[model samples]
Target: MVTPAGTLALLHTSPVHVPVFDGLRDRYHPGLVLRHLVDEELLRRARSSGSDAVAGPVAAALAAAVADGADAVLCTCSTIGGTAERQAGALGVPVLRVDRPMAAEAARYRRVVVVAALRSTLEPTVSLIAEESGPEPSFVSTVVVEGAWELFEAGDRDGYLDAVAASVDRAPLSEDSVVVLAQASMADAVERMSTRRPVLASPRLGLAAAAEAVAASAAVRAGRD
Candidate 1:
């Protein structure tokens, strides 16, 4: 009657991510336990020093946290895939980089456009996703929304999502193609967009997959016991 699920630790760059994970946890299992590690300063430095500079430290921090007891580590930032993978490799634990699932999903479509709030966040993610795609989608591109981050920082959260939604609305989203939102913050607006094209957010995909992984791991462990 009792199911023993493992711990899932989410490492994020800001407090904004907490809500997303909480939503996932509530839906997946009432008993599912979750934890967080926020590196706001690293994010601040990344803003000026570039996304790559912050990746190493953030991933290393997450690795240490997982090694202590966490069953899995999920990196919420889409901009630091390389660093996260490196850290995941070193830890030898299940590290779910958020974008991989979305990227894999996007590969199912012919043309895919990734909408991102920051240029620094877009390039690396687009590259990594494109590389994972193998065949290279017809158009793997980014639509950058300038100043959305400032609105978020200024406590205009709705404005930020509205602005992002407006940008997504304006995009020439193809009916047959898929649209992926490159940031976790962008995940909130997918339902608001009335696009014929599919909109994928890495965090949602990652969290859903992580929940399943947690369930499967628990089942396997129970059998072994």
Candidate 2:
């Protein structure tokens, strides 16, 4: 479907997230229109250097998504999410980072174990958790699920998810620790995990926030009308 005005634009680094978010919209927010914008280069560039390397493009992408008639932009890339949200002053419309809600939830716990398939995602997700957790955040542990990203790159999706779930399950954590799936691709691993700790993923939480943003924007527009 065309991305009509007032639609929630999803900015993703990987094409894999399109169906994931679309499914979320279908099940939870059926009335919410979604537009998926995938730019693998943004993530590829960030992986090569760092999040700083892709800040300009990330900001540009958020602006472009809004320019294309998005009422709100939900950036699905945790690596560049901070950059996208920092543009709130200029973007005018709401820009939601998918991981923020997850991060906020992670803050409430005494310890947060962040899991991801890619090495590049560890720092960004961990740092965001701390930033949201206030002046003194919880002790954060990171587990980079080895070989999982390679499986994903090789199109072994099930293998990738299996590796992720297995790695998180195998990680040593206190029963009270909160587990956070740092990447959107790894969200589904929750169902596969045997870990007793609370696990949080961004897809559903992020999209729900975007749905609210869309509603608030519509409300404002109606008042203006």
Candidate 3:
């Protein structure tokens, strides 16, 4: 697949993500052209079955993006992120896990808190933190905010944000601990919190990394040509 320069395709599991990621692209990577492909069923399957069950869909999405002339692909759903990255190499384009950069940042802190609205995201997020943290171990705690996803699904954005924020506030976080919002949608909630601890959110960091990856891929291809 011959991808055009400065083109980024995001494979999202929900249509709700299009605006969120499009906004991030506009703010962080304004020069790059952004495209979105949504599969609403992917997340439901991932949550109910497993990430491996959605591997085929993830690979298909990546291939479709590359076929559509995307220089790189971003998997916006953390639930399917591992599968997307695993298949990235075969697609001939960068496929980035949205929480990777946030995981890297969280790994730097001695104590870390990972908060998620879905149970499926916890393991992948913790695994990413472990991978990024290297040989050294960090104290990582996880919190799954109850009712947050329901509120989000019901279109009660404020209710969802409040639930997440309240969960973060109730977490056993120290002043030195860094909090990580495990899902991109939780970013807004973290921003609204009054905690003194540093909070890491995936969207901005992930998109920045995606932009860099795309630019590097473009440069490499240009040199090769």
Q: Which of the numbered candidates is closest to the native, going by highest lDDT? A: 3
> Where in model 1 is the C-alpha error above 4 Å?
1-4, 215-225
Cα lDDT computed for each candidate against the true fold: 0.76, 0.86, 0.87
The TM-scores of all predictions, comma-separated, are 0.88, 0.93, 0.94
Per-residue lDDT value at 116 in model 1: 85
Instruction: Report lDDT (Cα) of residue 108, candidate 2.
Output: 92
- For 1-225, candidate 2 gives per-residue lDDT tens digits of 222235888989889999999888878887788888899999899889887888888888878888887788999988888878888779888988899999999999999999888888888898888889877679999988888889999989889989989998898999669999999999988888888789999999998888888888867776788
Clashing pairs in 2: none
Q: Total backbone clashes of model 1?
A: 0
Worst 10 residues of 2 by lDDT: 1-10
Tens-digit lDDT string for candidate 1 (21-59): 887677655566778888777767776887678766876
Q: Sorted on TM-score, highest at the top, how do the candidates line up? A: 3, 2, 1
Task: Please give the lDDT score at residue 155 for candidate 2.
Answer: 89
Task: Give the local distance difference test score of model 1.
Answer: 0.76
**Model 3: CA > 4 A from native:** 1-5
